[model samples]
Target: MNLMTLYDDVINEDCSMIVPETLNTPHLVLRYFRPEDAERVAELAGDIHIASGVLNIPHPYTIDDARDWIGQHRFLRDHGEEIIYAITVRESAILAGAISLRVNTEHAHAEMGYWIGRPYQGYGYATEAAGSMLELGFRGLSLHRIYARHLSWNTTSSGVLTRIGMVHEGVMRGHASKWGVFHDVHWYSIMDDEYYSSSVHADHPGRDPSGV
Candidate 1:
């Protein structure tokens, strides 16, 4: 598990705006979405398995759906309410998946979530992207806490959360209704102090300077 920390210099004043045009990881690039990505986004996110694992994405994801979804990103970021990124492999620039952070202005915290395309599973891309998001939450955004919840059956999602140094808080029994039935959700979180004290965050070698 190679956990890369967000460089302190990347964050702008007060983190009212955390994302720049793009973020670089050792093997990935997290960047703002473009209209041209609609086709690939639709192809990757259209998997029934992928849609079933997340709360929001609908199955049979269409090109129009992808376009509409990417269209909302700019407005969300401009309002300081959310930060979403398109994940791509650094080597090939393949659209691997998507990740996001939903900010709670009143509480100074955010909910982080991500999904790796079916073809990209088992490559650690989701974990890598999520680690960057966590850095944005704790360091860039000056958030007190960052949390995420996954349906109980989604162990891969749980593993990604664990790999990022988030602690399992507990399970909310049947806390969410999805696909017309209730499901248990596992909650995990990391606080600012915990993020600073963690060896994972401390040993980060800083951002990649090669530029994405």
Candidate 2:
């Protein structure tokens, strides 16, 4: 069993917005994972394309595995160690993916990670959920930095990180091993200042990025 801690409330300017809720997008919604979601999560996470791209997702995903994963997440978030959300669709209610922020309360930073199912590849759901998490990290958690990393060979992951405004911070050569081989990793991040300034500018009626 993966043991986890419960919440220790962190102060944020928009503390009220820190509550758990679903975030909607054109084709999907980011929400909490339920026990019933284990089977579907296993299905989506079982594929080599999805599992191999990630650090810990096993290729032959099982119901027990999924259950344990979600259980660990619930425990961790409840203890305030991290926050995670399931990426699902409103119409189908299928588990399409996941997004999470592993917090470093002392450093006021969190690392973001995600993976989309093989069938949903090429769509923009990854970036969409990523944007939502970034919003939560900066606006709700009041975090100072959010960083992400990917295997150097994974162009798709690199694209998602770059598209979200994180710069290539460099590589960690042979720093990690997966699938019987060592791999290099690319790091990227966004600072709190950038998020805050962008938010203020977007809220100004005349200068709104959405241009309502």
**Estimated TM-score per prediction?**
0.87, 0.83
Worst 10 residues of 1 by lDDT: 203-212
lDDT of 1 by residue, 1-212 (tens): 11122544433333345467787787789999899999999998899888999899998899999999999998888766789999988887888899999987668789998888887877778878888887777766677899999999999999888888999999999998988989999999999898888877432332342332
Query: What is the clash tally of candidate 1?
Result: 0
Strongest candidate by lDDT: 1
lDDT (Cα, tens digit) per residue for candidate 2, span 6-121: 22234333221233567766666899888888898888888878888899888788999999998887667755577889987555666778988988766878899999887666
Model 2, which residues run further than 4 Å from truth? 1-18, 198-212
lDDT of 1: 0.82
**By TM-score, who's the top model here?**
1
